[model samples]
Target: MPAARSGSTRSRPIRRWCRSISRTTRSSRIVSTRPARCARPRIPISTRSSPTTRAGGCSCARTPIIARAARPPAITAASAPRRTRTRRRRPRMADQNLIENDEPLLVAKSLSKSFGRINACRDVSFSLHPGEVLAIVGESGSGKSTLLQLLSGQLAPSAGHVSYRMRDGVARDLASLGEAERRFLFRTDWGFVHQDPAQGLRMAVSAGANVGERLMAVGWNHYGRIRDTASDWLTRVEIDTARIDDAPRTYSGGMRQRLQIARNLVTEPRLVFMDEPTGGLDVSVQARLLDLLRSLVAELNLAVVIVTHDLAVARLLSHRVMVMKGGRVIETGLTDQVLDDPREPYTQLLVSSILPP
Candidate 1:
């Protein structure tokens, strides 16, 4: 009976091993089928208001994965689209119509000047009429002052011609005139107000002498009449008649400027060339001087060509404005038109930069 029981235990062990092997085989089949199960995609169930498909009208089942990834995120009011601004058009100036009827008092035709390879003034041509004030404005080294010098005969142009009408109504080329005739014209028909009072005035001499010297140059030899005329001019420019005997060195900056103006205008010149007449003065003093200058210019019906960097001075005193850049006339027109609605980009920048008074 013991041998039979041992044999039955061995058989039982073999049956148990076969059952464990069957279980292992089933577990391996299940693990291997997981990948195939995952490979088959589930059919997407459609709803009335699906977040992804509702707006785009696309089915999630057919939608490309790349297309989904490439879609931009939603935008709100805070993320409104931006747009670029277009530039406004500039206005045309009516300069030709304004100066058509009047014969130009001074005509510069194709004026040009060159220093070595540098063109200091290039083909700058403009007309100045009688009783009209033209302001040439630009930054330092822009050739505005050089153009003034050329027009005034202080510097000869490398090319071009300047013609000025004589008292006898003949337009004479200034460059062709003799030195004596030019000197005579400068003393009688023209006046120049230098930027520095020392240059314009006889600094060592008395103010009366400074003014009377101009009269003497034009053949006013009577000492008493010259002194009387000088005294009258001193009063006219708002300088104290008593200070007429004082040297310009003893005077203030504004006074010296005033004295210089008196000296230039005392002869009643038909044309005047000013190089920053109101420069180097306090704002209040400049305003007063500008007023005085405007009054005198109008009263005398003087034609003027003024060179200045100050746009405010140009706006205040000039009938026409010429904007220079890189030795070229970039823009020019009536003063109000140029200052109020500048056409050129550079001129617009200049007009915009002016501080309001």
Candidate 2:
């Protein structure tokens, strides 16, 4: 009985010692743990247009240009793009707005000219309409040429104004333009035929050269056209085409004058100023030239202003006549009425002196 009790007590003591060691180990346990740390990937906001026309990966909606980031630098939310302002467009108007209402192609308003003591022209007012021919007639030294020069923009008027047609087909007050501005008109709009044939034609050059010289003056260099135009003009003016190459030096007075006319007319100038066109030619030749000029003017719808002492030339060529004396216009009327009725004393004298040419 004593031996059995001692063995049971020893087994119980060993079980209790193992249980105590297990409890101490459980209390001393350490738990190793870390907070969650995952990487957030950086995304770029693209503003560049796509290279392909189809815009494969483009994010741009309009023509806004995107700026590149600063070199070797990190970007932040504060460094965003700014917007640009667009310009406001204005409406346009027609050139008719630039011109005064319903003015003639040329208007010489109270135009006066004085070469020192000599009063060449005074208070000369006239208007030239498109397709109309006007003749200014007077005795020698009565300022007809001077008035023509003034209207043609060759000489600036000492007083008054001249208006010439512009690109809009409206007359512009020439007094408003500087010399440089007026040159623009001379380059394109007008032509002049001088009283002297020599002044109109270059004597050294051929008749063809004389005719085609205007084309050259206006910057035309095409040889075939120049040749054809010159030849055609020669034929039109009744000059023989075989004589087209001959110089004015070789030509008679009438031929020289005809050449001069052909030279001025070939350009088909809108407004032409002629000084005594049929001055020296015989009656038959004068009639021929006048007929030719009339046909050409009608065909081309040309406007002309002629300064002449020849009443016959005025009657033949012009629709209207302005009689000037002592630097003033004495009478102005339709050509037939002025010639036949003779309102002014000077007109009567001129009509009486004509001798029924």
Candidate 1 local lDDT, 1-357, one digit each (tens): 011122221111111111111011122231111111111113333333223323322233222333333334435456668777998755343454344326777999999999999999999998888889999998889998899899989889999999998877688999999999988888888999888888988899999999999999988999999999999999998999999889999999999999999988988898999999888889999999999999999888889999998998998899999999999999999999998889999998888877887
TM-score for each candidate, following the candidate numbering: 0.71, 0.67
C-alpha lDDT (0 to 100) for residue 17 of candidate 2:
16
**Error in Å for residue 206 of model 2:** 1.4
Clashes of each: 0, 0
Look at candidate 2 and tell me the lDDT of residue 34.
Answer: 22
RMSD to native, candidate 1? 26.8
Q: Report the lDDT tens digits of candidate 2 across residue range 1-357.
A: 011132221111111111111011112231221221211212232223222112221122111212211122333346546657898755333334233324578888888899899899999888877778999999998889889888887888999998887757665787778887766455456777776789877899888888777788778899999999899888888889999888999987778877887787776677888988888778887887788878887887678999999888889889999999989999999999999999888899999997752
Root-mean-square deviation (CA) per prediction: 26.8, 21.4
